[model samples]
Target: MTISDILRDSDYSLDLLEKHIDDLTIFQKEQKSGLTPPYTVCKVRKKEIKLTPEEVVRQLYLIKLHKEYGYPYERMQLEFAVHFGREVKRADIVIMDKIQPTVPYIIIEVKKPKLKDGKDQLKSYCNSTGATMAIWTNGKEIVYYHRKDPNYFEPIPNIPSQNQSLKDILTERVSIDDLIKIDILKTQRRSLKNIILDMEDEVLANAGVDVFEEVFKLVFIKLFDELQNTRKLSTHLEFRNYGESDSELKVKIEEIFAKAKKQWGGIFNDDEKIRLTPSHLSVCVSSLQDVKLFNSNLDVIDDAFEYLVNKTSKGEKGQYFTPRYVIDMCVKMLNPQEEETMIDTASGSCGFPIHTVFEVWRKIYKDLGIEESHLFTAEKKHERALEYVREKVFGIDFDDKSVRVSRMLNIIAGDGHTNVLNLNSLDFSRWEETTKDESWQDIYFDGWRRLKKLRSDKNSDKSYEFDIVMANPPFAGDIKESRILHQYELGKNASGKFQTKVGRDILFIERNLEMLKSGGRMAVVLPQGRFNNSSDKYIRDFIATKCRILAVVGLHGNVFKPHTGTKTSVLFVQKWDEKLCPKKDDYPIFFATMQKSSKDNSGDKIYVKNSDGSNRLDSHDHLIVEHDLYNHDGITQDGIAEAFLEFAKKEGLSFASGKCESPFDEAKYKALLDGLEVIEINFSEVLIDKNIRFEAEFYNSKIGLSDNFLYGDDIIDFV
Candidate 1:
């Protein structure tokens, strides 16, 4: 049987054991009776063993120890016995000391696949035999630890080779180049989310402190430590633990955190301090030291922050963070230019604005002809891109924790200045009262001043003139307070009398439209009911009056799973203007429905795979999530966004060039043009149509096509 067959229905993976397959396969013996599975000879014990799932991991780890780490067979022992007061248990694998063959130097455990179980067993073995190091793996993720004492176990990047000492591994000088090569996230196939979960099981669950605050502090300090060497490549990183006492390491980390707060202001209070104990801090730092936070995208940090925020009150308000892939699709469909100003009205973690920054940076690099490399995210070479982020991009949110996370991410993208503010977008009347506080002025005054310059009217906060707006506002509850509801036209009934309550997302639809200029465009995520339900026709009517609908892409039901399953679709529109978007009574709208969810039923991401059934990595050495919304930098197939781009060009949209081309014969084209007449049927006139529905599925079903059908120019012709 193949290795994959042997490891099926188990928690083990063959990712780390690929190299040793040929070495072990030569000794495989097939059963003559054909009634039992195959077996293999162990390299260390030189005896035949049944190739069960655990045995496969044990045998492959032995080969890695000998080949990669330079350990010899003479120093390694399998099932070594350990004695406790008249009780004895056998260890999985142990590397004996150099001078004394009976003493264990490094204890490796492969029996338990889960980290917590394996770690607990390793601790017992180390405490009994007085071993200084321990190792744990299940053929997917590997962690090395140094047993500092009976009470503490600190994680190390890697174990020393045969010629090296423990001090050699701890005291090695590391630069950013070293970090890029050895980032644990890539090498061990571990994500930041999994690392945080490990930390919680190790210490944070009972640390008597707020888990979010402590983790945020560590991440803030670690980011600062990496930024110090971004431009200067040879500088040594200061975020590691190098054989120092717990108290000394705490002092050093605290000093670095202080510097981070000074560098990125408004994230924390001036008097704030790390509350994790010295021992707890040491364990946490060692776990995070080997990870590279900056990549071509900040998805590593974004995933971790989403988990932390969701553990608190973020879910109760129906404010799940937007997935990065969705943000990318919106940005690509909009085709935001370098000169355009963008904003996210209900910015949760600022995904739209930050991705906009990346999109603009891609354009700037093309204009300057600067070829991007793997260091694109970490390097600060383009001054124009930084200038655009500082001056043009903006985000606003009411949640304080989310605002801090948004500001921190924006600061990293902009190199210092951030236009992200903590404010309520719907309640514009209270902004003046809130901005008067001296403490608020200290942090938000500069951004507030810049925002006032974009207002269409200086005397009121009701309207602004931004080029683009994108948002996924909260949709769970209703606004019962008449004070907030009175400001929105959607708050009124058919007779123009204000209603007592309205859905929160309904008001944001009006609020987002008001923030755009005459020719500006926007994309907003709304519930499917808003487009199909007969009771919500007034909401659709209000939208059709102000702008020309561009496109509507229906999302899968699993897009926001493990939280809520409200089916949603993105509504794209552009305000009518004399020059950019002339008023049109009859226009064809592009429609599409997504097939691939990009996530499984459990809300975990499903990565693209190669023909050999191995996970696929992009050009940046990151796993690619399988989806159909858009092509991911050429890694995925061209999808709906690409189809819409072609349609926009054919329709002569303002952002796209060229006019519609005909496929008929030259003589037939003349006859068709002569017979055509200009037709004007206002969209509002369709309010009385009994079968009216704005959803893409409702339209696509009428054409006898499935959601997964490939769309191109011919599909637009059919429309």
Candidate 2:
């Protein structure tokens, strides 16, 4: 049966709703021939009932809340037919699972769709019953009110219900700790043994130096042993002197790599086959796997007998790890789901990847109610998150150390197969044969396959094509020895391209764009100069033409503490389709400045400056403010960043000030003075607007101020 039908039944007594009901706007319906006994269709009208149902539902919720809480609505008196005090009304049905009808535990006021006095009537009823909780609803939305004390019915959240059971209401009041005893974070931490074992397996299989080192050293010793018997000038005869010549060591390392490659099938292929020689073993010792793992104090034995290598090979550029909070904001904006394949081209330390894991974990456990234990390594958790590491995540970096570190970090974070590649992005040798001349072809190919797999069509539906890309590429970084830029046709003519003197940072931007599919979104940290310098025109034009800028966050100089003092700006852009660009001849772009609302004892509120030089500020010089920073708000130490982003979303406008007209136009002034009689008058004061005037009183005192003001036309040479 419908709730209204049961409530309107003649058998029910509304003594439970007496005081809270301010006015009853009742409507009458004609009694049909087959109608039952309960038919009270009396039209009732009253004040405080003008609000629509939606408004009524919201107000009713406020009525039950305590005063100290966020929204309290019970303070207002309930208006009744007798006229007691000011009335606050709520509408519809109320749930009172805790109260009994016979004892009058609580009361709720109900109102029909057209009834305006529902809240007033509910208030009066609350006063009459002295119940702590009350409710009002208009069927679609419901509100609950609870009294903190006898005098008030404070509004509380109307918990969604299937059946109004006391257990359900009590459950709502229980603390989160009461609901779940296990601490997911603490459980993961306690599983250090499993994490360490996993690390051991991973290091051996992937970065696992001991296994590969043993394999490489065995091959090395066997090759030398064979060479000794064959009298083949023993490859070992080449560089027995280790400490003397670094050059010889390099040449020996290269020769061994060559021999190792030849021993394997000549070129790197889809087949998982690798060969080793003495040089290969030595090179492995110098590889990133050897150095980082060998030095780790994770209680694992390091076997140097197996050619320990720690060399950060080709494209293994070191990258600074962006902080967690920064990644939080960036990833939140990117919002990648498990279904989405994420790619971080610069992939520094895999902060975004780690953040992605946490984000997915939150959604799976908290939002999806997938149980915190399911996120644990417990038996049930493994199957649910097993596929997450390999196909779900992708990261590429030129740094081999980054690849190893990123891979391990993810594995430790519970995703085993993190797709991190170590190769130079600038090298295209693997894609085209002409690029074979490159020295690091194998490393380049490793990265190329990873990139291709990321942008592949098969995975298109799994995630948005590069739904989010984020990075803080090097600042004023130069690539004097880049093999990638050397081959680019576009790099030949462009001013910022292919110049060794030009910063590597400039190239990274171009590379980042290439990595992104059209219409993809990106938030990259860059140097402040990129926003205004004319030298960056090529890059700026590319950004404007290719993408829609969502916002730019100007961070404070402090954001990079312990790092360099270089000021940074985050440019949030989404790859835009041509259809999305604004029409031509639109007004200059506008930015809304964001400022901090509060300050510390120092009185410096962190603020950012928009590129346009405007600010949302009471004062930038004397006072400062910091807004509650979050991924949603685009928080920066500086207030200007939010404004810059807002400006980008609007018209494509330059924030630079227009050049001032030359105040001393010598030639024009001379021409005007020669052709006409000129009169000069000096004024001490210049009035700008109502209530604002600029005055030089010394000059005004010397020459009495008059109504006539001096104009260029009337000016003549005078002392």
Candidate 3:
């Protein structure tokens, strides 16, 4: 089988396979030689060698470097040895200097998908070979980087052309918007999560401490280092560089981490030190020190955590990171205004809450109409952004790791990590269990004080009143525990007795509703079965009694694919209100179904590409994907959410700020236009929906005044 066939047969991620196939096919087509199985011709070696899985990746990249990147084949070698500390190791592929063929210029490590972490080996090779530039790939994900002096590897967006110098890659900066445009990001990119996973593989797997806790600690220290080295008004982050030896760097890093621990409080022991050996800790510091953490958005961080945790931990619980574009559409359709209190009940990585913070900050940042490059310090934007987060935004998750992650994102979003709590959303009755921590009380006292004002019970926020709520609660398991089931309305029978089991999402529905105030809006993703299953009618009834079902927008089946293909829908509702959601309930409801949710039938994401095969970006520098679910990005010719809003306005839905207009006389209008033919209409929003419609016939004048006679007293002369 060809190299492409091997990757495909491996059953690795389809996205990874597709990317490798594209790169490999182009290289193979350039060769006019033996590419078949028994022996594959090496374009550089100018001879046929046994085709192995590792050889496939090496050969494919060799052609890529030679043909596409303009690296001369004469400078490339099949087996290049470098002297490690005690032994000489051969890298899979190495490129030599143009003038000095014996000196290594670039080193590449190629492996298969199942080989979990190749970064450490690549780092070692680069260090030993004195090759400043190196690449690590597993025929799937690739990381291209250039090592700075003294052990720092800064990521390069891509490998440069032969004529392009390495400095060319370092000078360029990518925005979060442009970063999302790279579909290959999921396939061949380096991230903080990958580094953590690498550490787990190389060090923490045998370390005595919990892997999650240790990774969290390193990340915490890294974040603090980034914070301490902030640029003007905290506009940017500058990473620490070292000229010291590994042991010296270890001591210095531990000192910095200790300072961070004391400042952050509660997450770790006050005297906590780096748990890994000095050499391992030094290696990690060197690997991570140059990465610009704040250059991109939180989605990058979330992708890392989701990837690292999914394999060993969260995947079994059916919790996947919600794609950012999906979260953006929900935020757009919901239209959260500034200062609105919001909460995400099942806040995995806090995407919904954090994006809502982004939405609000965008408005506040632009209200003056000034175009500033960066926002928003905890003290910038009048510190209103931080105030809004502290008082108005909240998130909760039962999982400690998830809660810690959720808190990290919020802390970066604003100085409001305390707003995120680690309580079981479904078991609100025992929320005191989380609140009882005196340290938790110390950090969260102010935010909890604001929350207490909304509670029906002064002591607990079980009946808390939030203006808006959005969540994608976990539903992998059933609530078989009787004590947990006893609290939810969905856990009961018609006779008011508790049932032995209930879906976790079913209970989330009850708890989420209880959290909202009268007239508050909610947009939540639920399994489509909850909307149509015969046995779930009671769940629907429970919702109906508590709120007005304003909209039931059926999400495309592929929306959550490659994660869980169970069809789901975002059910939008408003608690029954005297003005917004009527108790009488005869009003017209907005209905829509997503035509596209970015991913295809096989769950492979199809990002729009340019003629040169790069991701197509937007005016805002965002990588534009096929998100026809909403008109927020204008990726589609027309969107269902956009059309539904127009329909809601025409139907005079109260929540839509709809105006009642004069009824149209269809027969009279048709008769008027019958002879006039085609008409152009323009709706004026400034006026009360009055617009011009004209039918111009070629047989007559454009206006055709004679055919359109109105014999009024003022126009008596007009016949």
Q: Lowest-scoring 10 consecutive residues by lDDT in candidate 3?
A: 710-719
Sorting all predicted structures by TM-score, with the top scorer first, yields 1, 3, 2
Q: Judge candidate 1 against the unseen true structure and give its global Cα lDDT, from 0 to 1.
A: 0.82
State in Å the error of residue 543, model 3: 1.6
Q: What RMSD does each model have against the real structure?
A: 5.6, 26.7, 12.4
Q: Which ten residues in a row have the lowest lDDT in candidate 1?
A: 710-719
Candidate 3 clash pair list: 142-188
lDDT of each: 0.82, 0.40, 0.63
Find the candidate with the highest lDDT and give its number.
1
Per-candidate TM-score against the hidden true structure: 0.91, 0.39, 0.71
Give one digit per residue, the lDDT tens place, for model 2 in 1-719: 22233334222222222222233332323466653332222122213333333333323333333222322122222322222466444323332323353333334454433122444565565565454555554432233444444433333333324234323442342222221222111211112222222223323344424453343433332332223322333433231223323355445544554553344321222332333333333333222111111101111111121012222232223244554445665665455566655667677567776667666655555544665432132112344455655456666666554554454444445423446665455453443442244654443444345445655364332122565577777564556555555754335334544554446566666666656665566778877677655456556666666665555555545554433445565666666554433333212321111122233334223343344222232211111123423422223332232223232323332221112111333344334333222222121122122343333222114333333223222211110
Query: What lDDT is reached at residue 521 by model 1?
Result: 93
- TM-score of structure candidate 3: 0.71
User: What is the per-residue lDDT of model 3 for residues 6-65, given as tens digits with 9 covering 90 to 100?
Assistant: 545552322233343444432232346755344566778777676666776677778678
What stretches of model 1 exceed 4 Å from their correct place?
Answer: 26-35, 82-89, 657-719
